[model samples]
Target: RDLHNRGGERFIYNLRAEPATPEFELHGKYYYAQLAPGTRMIWFVNLSRQNGFTGPVELKVEGLPEGVTATPVTIPSGLTRAAVILSAKTGAKIDARLVRLYGKAVYSDATGKPRDLVRYAHVTCELQVSGGSQARRPINTQIVGVTNPLDIVEFEATPSKITLRPGEKVEIKVRVKRNKEFTGPIQLAMPFLYGNSIIADQLPPGVTMSSDSKARLTGKTVEGTIVLEAATGDSAPKPLERFPIAVMGRISMSFSISTNYASNPIHLTILGADSKAAR
Candidate 1:
């Protein structure tokens, strides 16, 4: 059944399925995990890119060594990572084996129809004595896991929305909020780009965020602003549109610890040459 409610210029149409297939890519061919018997460990399956797939996903591990079991993981809608918990019995076998990983993307289609997409990965599972080191395997790459320090920092930008025309310029301020009772270092980062309905370090130029290649944390909290200039004359890429904003950076407590972190993207509405925002 379908529902089409007649409304002003913006009517509602309940789609039963998606117009096209949504895509989400999972990277990493193998994973390395080791833990003591009766103990548990956490790992992750990283995503190389998410192609407009805004839905929930489920992940599971299979073929682990005897006495070791994996608790399935489910990624909520709009998130790009999944964490799996591996637990070993007190008397579990101490051995090494190849295991299989699985992922299923679940979501609703445009027509409100339920749908699912699936993917598979391979992992080299190892069970060993607690605190013991095992020889690194060939496929043990991709340094993303559960214990990243950069994951805890917070970020925000001021004057989130701005209006600009050809040859116009503006200044936007960004701030990094840190956790209470703790002070270390935080940095801000984002590609120098303007498009895709989001503007970061482009437009007015004169960006003052120090290192755009790698935003290193300098203090427990940080704040800065950048100049953005709109294209002028005949080379303007956009006439009038609203774009969102996002910033990325790294956080580290010590020289040996660091991870990547990004701010929650926000929208920026632009009113210029031929924007349809007013309608």
Candidate 2:
């Protein structure tokens, strides 16, 4: 990871970390996640293999500040990336800290005996009381603090579930309940995008939001519609059961940074053109 100190000077600590033997390196981007109490963020992990090393790696995060927790990840052999979900509890303490990312695996030694090996990486985390503020820290450290809850407290999609056929179109209504502390406008969407680039999308392939959607929720406006259109013929997604999706409320902090809150997941089912539901 490339990191900068509080003074803005950029450097990497591992420039001289050359290993003399065949091994794998655990690494990931310097992630800056600012989360509030009761919110969560997804952190990504990466791996680099050297000297013909090919083994499954078990990954985990350590040194998380109080009130913040993360689930461990496992990168299978031949895979380069994995993700960990970090969540904060309600009434969590306001704090920040640097966390450690470690990976372990078993390899056969020259004597054909299984040997345990481990590697390390660093990540930064922060929990802030407000959004859109710049908080600086040393490399390989994370910050966790408490911020105000998002304007969207909770939301639900009407219909609760969906069953549609190929070439059919439907609309899902999202009703957002505000936090009362935040009265600003909020954009309700199904896909999370960063500056015209898709970051994470919740919709399944062949089922897309329509172009003419009015999904902006302003003051006193709590209801919005998301029109989903299924593809026709061969382009239609194959019959699938119980696809989970949710609505995301986005508040942009900058060109590349934003805070997103998600609603409950709803199930969607797609049927073939000539298929019929069982009685």
Query: Which predicted model would earn the best TM-score?
Result: 2
Model 1: what TM-score? 0.36
Q: Please, what are the lDDT tens digits per residue for candidate 2 over residues 86-121?
A: 667777777776567688888887778898888776
**Candidate 1, 11: how far from true, in Å?**
51
List TM-score per model, in order.
0.36, 0.54
lDDT of 1 by residue, 101-127 (tens): 667877667787987888764333333
lDDT of each: 0.49, 0.66
lDDT of 1: 0.49
lDDT against true structure, model 2: 0.66
Q: Candidate 1, residue 213: CA error in Å?
A: 28
Off by over 4 Å in 1: 1-20, 28-30, 109-112, 122-279
Task: Summing lDDT over every window of 10 consecutive residues in candidate 2, give the lowest-scoring window.
Answer: 5-14
